[model samples]
Target chain A: MSNGARNPNRWLAFSASIAVVALTAACSSGGTTASPDTGTGDGGSDGDVVLEFAQWWEPELPDGVLRGLMDEFEAENPGITVELLSGPYASTKEQVVAGAASGTMSDVVGLDGAWVSDFVQQGAIADLSALMDDAGYDQTQLASQVQLDGSTYMVPVVNFAYMLFSNDAMLADAGVDVPSTRSEFADAAAALTSGNTTGWILPLSLEAPNGIQNDVMSWVWASGGSMLDNGQPDVTNDDVKSAVEFIVDLDSAGVIAPGAATLKEQDKVEEFTNGRVGMMISSLAHINTIRESNPDLEFTISALPAADGYSGERGTPYASWGIGVAENSEHKAEAWKLIDFLMSESSNAQLADAANAFPGNTTARPEFVDNDPIFQEAFDVWQAGYPANEFVGLPVAEQLMRDFSEQLQRVLAGEISVDEALENAQAAWTDEF
Target chain B: MTATLTPEVEAADRQPTPPSSRVRLRRLWDRLTPFGFLSPTLILLIILMVTPIAMVVGYSLMDRVITAPESNFVGFENYVEVLTDPVFATAVKNTIYFAGVSVVAHFVLGMGFALMLNSPILSHRLKAVFRTIYILPWLFTIAIVAVLWRMLLSPNGIVNYLVTTFGFTESSVEWLSDPNLALHAVTFINIWSGYPFFMISLLAGLQGIPRDLYEAARIDRAGPIKQFLHVTLPQLKPIVISMALLDFIWTTQQFALIWMTTGGGPINRTEMVSTYTYKLAFATYDFSVASAAAVIVLVLSMVLAFFYVRHQKSRD
Candidate 1:
């Protein structure tokens, strides 16, 4: 055959190849393209302003509660519409970080205290102090604001404290009351240990190493101990070392849960819900989850036990659902208006009630606390102790936690002494700073 | 037409005609047709692979990136930092162990299963059931495999329950937690999930083996073992080498399974190069160092690919 006779076949092959390439590219692109409605608030039809609010709290709260609040905000402010972009915490963090890096962050964002410093360093989030002032917001009403270099980048909208949760039936079965001191706590934990049950469940997984900040550091914070001295890592200080040693002692006593090195927070909660553990240091945010998972499980919430003979005011470890306006947002005013509404006393109270958390406004109190005895107890614990979390606003906070957790695991495994572990962690943290 | 031409006339006739633009264009088109066919793939490779690799190399030589607005060029400092880090060293060692053990185990398990499936004594229906059962692990996504293995290997999970029930130990075994067992446990899971690919390939190879060779061996009074050692192995040698090399390359770059299961934890006991690079980039926001680690991993992967290509070429 002449070469010209084969041209159609060659053309067919070329077209087929091109089509495959196009199809592959389309498939691999996936869901990365943003829809016009969700696109970073470039004004909707007919001069209406669209503000994208990205957060992780929507999934945690009762379904449609956040959307209802946003609808209310839109009703009050006619020209502004709020869009909710929500996902699980990790994915939200990833999306926000990617957005920040690409200069396409949403108008408003939910902030974690651990992420605040990094965002501030990247200039990803707006300085809310000026925005609040410009909007005539009552700054004094805010319970707390995460600040870096004296500029408030994020304001807490709701708060959840990490407290000691005890399975009441297990404690009663073991004939141990809620322990309020270190020695008593250790004794109670040991007494509660039996077949298929441990006294305490510690999730030390390096994947989500906040277990170190929440579970291990809660011991230090309870007695007003600090992992930082003047904004620098002081992890090798006596208080931190002592806390590590205490955890090692508990591990030695076999009261801490097995497989802790791989267990995550959800796993700890599951063990507690399944009645496999007697106690756990858990967030108040998990209260509803625990109840939903095991309605019959009787549990009590209380302030973590302090070191003996340390009769000073205790510090409760707390995490918050913080709010911030993105630096790249075009509708900053509208974003601030939404933030102001969310931080208002009534709205904050409603949100807190729905989330089973504390209102971020100082004057706001969720009505549920008055009716639920457990919530009342948690409120009392909050009132009696100051919220403390030293890792908050620290640079590379999660990495620091991972470093400390790795060293702590080494100590627990008897590969290193407590002192050595602390020193190693200190060295690792020092490099980060 | 039969009249003889002078030398000058023949030379003039032999001289090429001054072609029209259409003819010249067709000639050019002919020359460009092959490149036209290859253009789509070349463009995709340049965009998807080459660009990203070049960017990573550039980032590796910078002081900071992504998180920092202003990044400074630093000559090989990030590489020096990563190479000197003790965790990086541990990651390299663990990656070698994890991949090496996984590849070897995959080959053994795959060969055993393939042999069973290819056995003449096995009924067709029974062989089909066995094949399905053996390939079930490979059907699961990496995420599902990680989660399933995590549940099975938990201290309070079924595996531990069985171990304790059988009086193997007085208490639950921490398969994924204990530093001593975590690397091996994850490697075992990798092996379980990976062997099916090799099994399928080897089964095809086994089926393609000529019956004449086995009959010849039998004529020579060869036993089953001797036939397998001689005719079967010789027939499967090229495929075996190719599959093993490819599996080794893929296994060494494993990230999802390790990330979902262990996160390279228990004091870096299970840390691999992928996890190390991930943590540097995402956890610490140290893109520069992460890029350096990534480039190192890329180089290692390229070396493995090199061996694979060389083997395939030699076989061809």
Candidate 2:
């Protein structure tokens, strides 16, 4: 045998050795577990702390604003440093969920009401009321606390009410007034439907089926009705049935936008921004997005149209930017300080103004409400109608919305009767509970 | 002093002496050489693949995993729950339809385009241009493909405009929202995005086919159709079977495109096993049930893989 054959084997062995070394080096460099004691008392021997604050809020706010706020907090608390880990809402939720499962959650975390119950169940979030008591923070100053089994797990940092948005030009062209009642709203929508445009946009994409909560159930809530009776699924009740019937009627009238079953919230906002739709029920958070997308588009804000002949204070659908302290965090006191700073009247107002939302502190009022008439009108609407979102703090809330949306899609498609659809939804929601 | 060695010493030197320690060590190293080359891959597979799979299997047999502090083994209860759900049934049916139709369409389109690109009459430049256009969809990431198709298939999108302009329809058609059309619409999108992969593979296979065979067929008075049926297909059979099986495995696991476009909506018309499992895990936080569903999907994939391996071995 030639010595060359033996040489090749030697070379192969050498290459394998090099590869093993490289792989070991790479693994050593990349394999970093998030420190369990990241926010603990022993985080630094010098009595300094580094708090990881994971949120979706920073990305949504104007660039540098959230970072600036964190900088201010760090300046005020000399020994404490805050780190911001931010991403879009969906990715943030996924990250937080993974972190919670692994016991590596950020010390201070952004929360959604839908996630509160699950987090509470897992004991992933700390009891905010207890922390507040330890910190001597006034709980009464907070607008609302999301409680699970009488323990506060999340506190609202800001609130965004979903309200009806009407394109002024479209409404004017259709000669329809801003709809205050369901019947008039349908008529206005019908009138607006002409020449490649629809009257209303309802996004019911099951991917993010908050539409069932924000768009469909808003009508039920507007009539001061509940989709739950004593914290159980009441989707088959008269209020929900009426709401579904109203939506089906709209579908039959062809006043609702086409492809609504596949449409998402951003798509609805786009349609409204383009003036392709006459009206939609949307969040106050989208106000700036619309203005940025189409500055020339004239629009007005109003309360969601109430069910006709329901003479009572309407309930407006609202979503919030909620804050919590991770239970795994050893620096619960430090985490609460961050929350307290954010929930302070001035800071909350500043955040709300920048985000075009309502302050979570009861006495805090966003400055945008004074100068922005549309915001003012929305604020007034919010005041007239108490914020109503029954799905909040419910177990598997998003799943509940999805179940309802799936059944509602069937109703809209005329594949099943409204009664049957509601019954099906009720059964599904019951199973989750 | 030139002392002469004794016959006994000479004989001892000639004996094997039970092989030296150095020789034994070399032999042992020779035996372990192949494993040394394979150790990195084996370690990776064990860590990345085997461990996660084992954990998921463990989760499949438990209740309230990942969410609850303490979980109890429920045997196959989670699996039973998932299997009995009507939505799971719908997901299975839809996944079959999606993968079946996608694979068939992908093969047909791919083979057709490959044949066209391989035609001798076409100039090389023309073929290059056509190839670029055909392969464009494959170049895009799945996310981009999904978003592009979404825009094109929107109710008021250009597709609708063209259809209406050509008098194919009276008004804008709801391609994605209509339950009847949504499954077909998404399958069409998948087919569009996936065919390029097959086309590229089959094109290579076509170029590798012996030109002398075709010339011999021509001399034998074999028509183009007969040549294709008798010669072309047989020549590409191995590649075709391999590509189709791989595509089936991939299409069955399609999640991103479906998730981005329809999200298994319009009354569960486009639900696939991937999306259903995802919903169970993420949307409802039912990790136990999701793991069970995942295990079921793994079994199905393993079965497909078994046949694929069998086919490859037969070809070899």
Per-residue lDDT of A56 in model 1: 91
Error of 2 at A310 (Å): 2.2
lDDT of 2 by residue, A169-241 (tens): 9899889899999999989999999988999988999899999889999999999999999999998899988
DockQ of each: 0.31, 0.31
Top TM-score model: 1
- Candidate 2 predicts chain B with a TM-score of 0.92
Question: Would you estimate the TM-scores of all the predictions?
Answer: 0.92, 0.92
Superposed on all Cα atoms, the candidates' RMSDs to the truth, in angstroms, are 5.3, 6.2
Model 2 ranges off by over 4 Å: A1-47, B1-30
Candidate 1, clashing residue pairs?
none
